[model samples]
Target: MFLAIRELAHAKIRYALIGLIIVLIASLIFIISGLAKGLSADNASAIQNMKADYILMDTDAELEMTKSFISRTDLDNVLQMDGIEQANSLSVRMMNASVNGSDQNEDVALFVTDGDSMLLPSVRDGSPITQEDEAIVDASLQREGIEIGDRLVFGEESELTVVGFTDSQRYSHTPVVFVDGGGRETINAIAISVDESRADEIRNAVGNSFDMVTKDEALKGIPSYSQEQASLNMMIVFLFVITAFVLAAFFYVITLQKRDQFGVLKALGAKTTYLAQNLVGQVVLISIMCIGIAMGLTLGIAELLPEEMPFLLTADEMVQTSILILIVSIIGAFLSLIQIVKIDPIEAIEGAGK
Candidate 1:
């Protein structure tokens, strides 16, 4: 460790170049990861907010909430089953909304459910929506100049008064709006709260006509959720591989360039293990410093992002990425030790003189 620190301080230019590479790669990983998570949250926050443990959809509908139609009879059947706590209809629809009489329209995801149902998001600014013509909206609507008491028009006759604003619960990248669908009891799906063990029982009771999937499984049913997640995951995998190879190649070259120096150290009674430790320490020190700088940059950039942009950097994610990078870098650095261990001090000194 002492030798490694001395070498790094004396060879500032060389170490700085490697550190810069680490910073760039680490920053790319952080930014891409944030994007992946943000996109997922934007796609499913509405469903994620549901208190229900399971989401029931028509099996024939292939898990798509938009395609599932749960009639009053199906809903009542599920509610009657043993171990069931509560069940309610939830209708999901996408529609254009605008303040009444305004020509400008913004796309919004509409969640129509029983007005008194507990499925409604906890209001942050005003009271929960209870009437046929009232609605609760995600805070994202505020970006478009919407506020409490503003009446948003839906279709030809339904005009909803914005009774409240709630924390973000966007679906498919659009803000969510909760409205009372009075006299329209038919629904896209049913949300149920039940014990984990009873989920199978409920599935049996509902028979082949219904599909009961945990909330997490239901997320894949949303359009593009799987594709988006898969693409970003692949990018991360590729980045990790690329980073590993790059570090290995860089350290291998550095070791080759310093062959005579390592040979001299070995001749002076330095153990192969000691030389290996020095190399590992240098890699770790460089990686840690670069990762730290990258984290600071990522956080600084996150604060500047627009609220509508779904970029999040959770602590767990940061720690996981940092640990993975360090592990891979250490492995790459170790690859260079092969040449170090094979060095014959006498041969190296003779070759250097020639």
Candidate 2:
């Protein structure tokens, strides 16, 4: 530890540059992770937070929710099965809506369900929607100044009254409006919140009856969400791999530069295990510091992003990935140590020329 620490302090300029590169790499990995996570959330937040154990959609449907439309009879069929606690029919439509009295006709998405079992985006400002024309806009939409009691126009003329504000609820990156009732008269899907014990029974029964789907199978129903998430995740994986390579390469070069010194220590009877320990210790220390700095920087970057950017962070993902960075750094360090094995102890002496 002392030798490794002293080396970094003595080579401040070189080490500082390496630290900066490492910081950037960590930042890149961390930010790409946040963005990837955010993209998945933006594409699936509403469904992710729904108050349902199973979602009912048509059998053999690509996406069981929006694209798979079922009628009231289909919804009724799901409720008849034993072990079904409760069910709510839902409809989601992609269309443009705007702030009342504002010119910005943003792409507004609607989640329409019967008033009995309203699911995503619990009520915050006004009452859970009861009437056909009443709507509860996601709080994000409130940023546009569409408040309760305001009239929002959906699809040119379908006027919906903003009855309340729900928090951070979105579907497909578009802000959601929760309309609790026949949902403009179209029952596209149903949400079933059932106890786990009875889930299998209900799933088997309803699946046989009404083409019901569970949460695991339902996410694909969203338009392009799977493809979008896959693409972003690939980028995130690439960034982390690239970070590991960059850090490994930097340390690899440093190990080469110190090869003669390492040889001298070996010739002085210092064990190879000790040299390897010191080298890896330096990398571990730098990795910890660099990742900590990058984490702080990523937070700043996330805050700097606009609210509408769909940026999201979760403690689970961040913690899991932070550990991943450390583990990957160690992996990188091990790879760089290949140079040490090839180093000759004679390099430490006066050489054969003497």
Candidate 3:
């Protein structure tokens, strides 16, 4: 460790260049990861925030909530099934609504359910929906100047009154509007709360007509949610691989340049293990420093991003990315250790003398 620090200080520009590359790669990873998470929330926060453990959809719907329709009879049947703790009708619909004060019609995702359903989001402002025509809208709508007491005209005669506001409620990149179904005959699906142990029983009780999917499965059902996340995650994986290769090549070259120095140390009784530790220490120190700086840079850029941009960075993600980068850096540094161990003191000394 002492030798590693000394060498790094002695060759600050060379090490800084390597660190700069790491910072750029790490920052890109963090930013892309944030977009993946943010886009996920924007696409399916309505379902992600649901308290239900499982959703029962029409088997023929292929996991799509909009295509699935559960009759009132099936909902009752599931409610009476043993081990079924809670069941509520859920309907998702996309429609354009004419904002009361604006001439433009905004696309909104309708989340219709029983007024008393636990699936209803708690209000962040104003009162909860208590009437069939009353609705709680996602807070994102506020950016467009929509507010409580405003009316959203759905069709020629149908209108919904905004009664409350909810945070982080969205679907398919549109803000969610929670409305009371008012004893609607059929719904898109049934949101249920049940234990994993009893999932089989619930599935059997619902019969083959309906499919019970977990939260994750339901998220994939949202159009483009899966594809967007897959692409971003793939990019993150590639970045990690590239970081490893870049570090390995850089350190290996540096190791070769210091062949005589390592040879002299080996002649002075430096063990391979000690030299290996110094190499690993340098990699770790550089990785941590670069990752920390990248995190700070990424977060600062996130703040400056536009409100419409989907970007979210959680502490867990930061920690995970940092750890992964550190591990990959160490692995890359180990590649250079091969060159270190192969340094022949006699040969290296003779060459230096010549």
Candidate 4:
């Protein structure tokens, strides 16, 4: 550790340049990861936040809630099935709504469920819908100057009064408006809560007409959700690979330049293990410092971003990324150890003298 610190102080500019590269790469990874998380929430927070364990969709609907429809009889049958704890109708629709008769309209996702259904999201402000035509909207709609008590006109004659606001309730990148289904004869899907032990029995009882899937599976059924996540995840994987290669190349070159120094130390009784420790220590220190700076920088950038932009950086993700980067850096540093271990002290010393 002492040797590592001494060398870093001696070659401050060289190490600083390496640190800068790491900082830039790490910061970019963090920012992109934040965007990925934000997009996921923007795309399916509504479904993801559901208290239900499984969703029952019409098998013919191809897992898409928009295309699925279940008659009230089917819902009742499933509700009465053995091992079924709770079940509620879920209807999803995409429509344009004008606030308080405004000429302009905004796209919104309408989620129709029973007034007292478990599928109903608890509101952050105001009250949940208790009657037909009353609704609770996602808080994001507040950005468009919408507030509690504002009337949302759905079409030529249909209108709804916004009675409350819920947080983080979005679908397909649009804000959600939850309204009472008022015992509608048909529903888009069924959200159910059941124990894992009883899942298979429930599925069998419900029959082959409906497909039962977990919440995550249902999120994938959302339009473009799977593709978007796949693309972002690929980018993150590539960034990690790039970081590994960059660190390996940088440390390898630095190791080559320090051959004579390493030879002198070895001749003076420094063991390979001692020198290897110094190398690992330097890499770990540098990685930690750079990653810490990158995290702070990324957070600052997130603050400057527009509210409309999807960018969420969670502490868990930050920690996981940092740990992965650190491990990669250590592995990269090990690549340089091969050169150190192979250095012939006599040859290196003679060459330096010549």
User: Best candidate per TM-score, number?
Assistant: 3
**Candidate 1 — which residues are off by over 4 angstroms?**
none
lDDT of each: 0.88, 0.77, 0.92, 0.92
C-alpha positional error of residue 353 in candidate 3 after TM-score superposition, expressed in Å: 2.8
lDDT of 3: 0.92
Which pairs of residues collide in candidate 4? none
Per-residue lDDT of candidate 4, residues 330-350 (tens digit): 988778999999998999899
Error of 1 at 196 (Å): 2.0
lDDT of 3 by residue, 179-274 (tens): 998499989999998877988887787777888888899998899999999999999999999999999999999999889989999999999899
For each of the candidates, the C-alpha root-mean-square deviation to the true structure, in angstroms, is 1.8, 2.7, 1.2, 1.3
Off by over 4 Å in 3: none
Per-residue lDDT of model 2, residues 227-324, tens digit only:
88788778877767877787788889888877778888888888888888888898888888988898889899988999777677777877888888
Clash count list over all predictions = 0, 1, 0, 0
What TM-score quantifies how close candidate 3 is to the native fold?
0.97
Ranking according to TM-score, highest score first: 3, 4, 1, 2
